[model samples]
Target: MAIQTAAKATIYRMVMPDHICPYGLKAVDLLKRNGFEVDDRWLETREETDAFKAKHNIETTPQTFIRGERIGGYDDLRLHLGKRVRDPEATSYRPVVAVFAVAALLALATSWAATGSLLTIAAGEWFIAFSMCTLALLKLQDVESFSTMFLNYDVLARRFVPYSYVYPFGELVAGVLMVAGTFMWLSIPVALFIGSIGAASVFKAVYIDRRELKCACVGGNSNVPLGFVSLTENLMMVGMAVWMLVKPMGVGVGH
Candidate 1:
């Protein structure tokens, strides 16, 4: 099939001190990829950029114009090109999936280094512990954002706002304890309690209420959907708590 070329597009972007606009480059690239010849215009100074924005009555930079018709910024250009443009608040699973994948890799590597094999029970435990820690860390980065999103679906958080803040810290502590294989007496209860509450909240929100919302599992800024990923995280915690409680001591220790 002959690749169809789009109409020529013009872009104006800023290149100032510590303020190189990334979307401008993206806009140029997208135009070229779609076979549109781009007239790349540079605003050399901050004053020029601001003046351009004022004249155009636009708020942001990297503005695009096609055949003398204003096409807005990078996102607008993308829409004009018929591409999937993700909303800032849209829900997705990429963040949680990425964290879990990385955790699994790290667990496998650790197990291989210690036991000279990848397939081991210790690896599974390590994977869950690492996943929990990573997820908690993301939430901790922006606790207020996480808490706000969490309150939307978390039953306990809805009742008590303080619990939303506490949840991340508790998750982090439980993950650390699990990884160290020490303080089972404390970690077990913490994991079980949080896990049970999380599972119930997710079930009620997604299944019973049928509400679609973003998950705070990866973080408040993330777009991870509130459903299977959330349920899996809670289930992992529950399983890890049970395993820690019943497993033979020192079985996976010192590795």
Candidate 2:
């Protein structure tokens, strides 16, 4: 069933800065485009809003209220919009892309393990490793983070250690095994399980701990909340593993 979202009067504001101010304008434009009547009163700060906030412990501007219900900040606002509307399609990947992505992940893991510095690994020296992992997973999976997911004994060590020792090495091993499919269908399942662990680790550290931190998962440039995205990604991999088990595609030489 589709979740019901509350009808809301939105307040989009940013602090004094032209660049930031445009975000509010853009939001107003989008909301209006979507058929919601844009009330300038909601956009502008009024004595009533100020008094409402003062009475109810609101200290932030650009705060949204739906018939007197508070709707937090920009991120919350965006999420609400996503729920209410659907957009046009962009690019769609063919199945071949997933195959290529898996092969690339395996190659990266193998190369990094050979002659790569432990610190290089710890510093997450292999950019290809993360790229391959993300691509193979369709930019869907994560290798868990600290303080966020399962917070076990294994997790504590990851926080203080370097990347080389943590993910890349293990990832390299598992990734290679996955591509090889040497152990029949076992390889993919094993890799998926390991990758799921990694995803959980990253997700836990970011969202649960509220750490607006960089994911040293691949290298950098991956800074998303480790929540539903992480879970969904792993679930996809799990589905792949099941497919491999049912239909073990004999390793074919890539042309």
Candidate 3:
């Protein structure tokens, strides 16, 4: 009964000995999920796939057609179905949000396991430390890209290009030191310095200059926006640095 009411859709996909188009499978799945009665057509050879493309005057395969109207590829089909498609070039905080979320969960889990409690002063400390380390690792993955992105708004990086390369390593060292509850003398200064610079840069870029751009916080190849998330990261570092410095002197709030 559901099949009788389903929309008729046609899909042309590649299926060969050495290659099978993943998009074709995705298209088929999408169609089925959206109550489409799909007429799955396969181009069984490379020549056949190329010929199909030439015949349609299209560059790629895994094409979908609905009721004799070409719906294009997997992304195009999604758009036709009114599904939200993420644009690669669009600014987003999703990556940063995911990183922080995972970091917080890890902190909570570890704290609970060690101290037999979910909420602890150490949990908050662990969250910030882990988040910093994770973000640094991401930037280190492609430092060239990260440096290029960092230079856009960072005043220090702009003046001294070497600072861009050094920033991730500094963050990593500071985070590791804080997590281990050691080397406050070294970690405090590094975190304070970088966090201060970062906060100023973000404030100038987003609030003062009002120049919209992608953040280099997660890495060079991210679409994270240069605003609140970036500021938050810097603020967290600053807070952590201050806490670490004061805790040893018996002047801080947390244990």
Per-residue lDDT tens digits of candidate 3, residues 58-174? 999899999999999999999999998888888888899999999999899878877788888888889999999999999999999999999999999999999999999999999
Candidate 3 Cα misplacement greater than 4 A, ranges: 1-5, 248-255
Model 2 spans > 4 angstroms off:
1-12, 18-30, 37-57, 64-132, 135-168, 173-255
Candidate 2 vs 3: which has more TM-score = 3
TM-score of every model? 0.84, 0.32, 0.92
Cα error of candidate 2 at position 38, Å? 2.9
Candidate order (lDDT): 3, 1, 2
Query: What lDDT does the true structure give each of the candidates?
Result: 0.91, 0.46, 0.92
Question: Candidate 3, 23: how far from true, in Å?
Answer: 1.6
Give lDDT tens digits, candidate 1, residues 2-115: 977667889999877777899998999999998888899999898898899899999998999999999999899899989989888776788888999999999999899989
TM-score of 1: 0.84
**Best-matching candidate per TM-score:** 3
Q: Once model 2 is optimally superposed onto the true structure by TM-score, how far is the C-alpha of residue 50 displaced, in angstroms?
A: 9.2
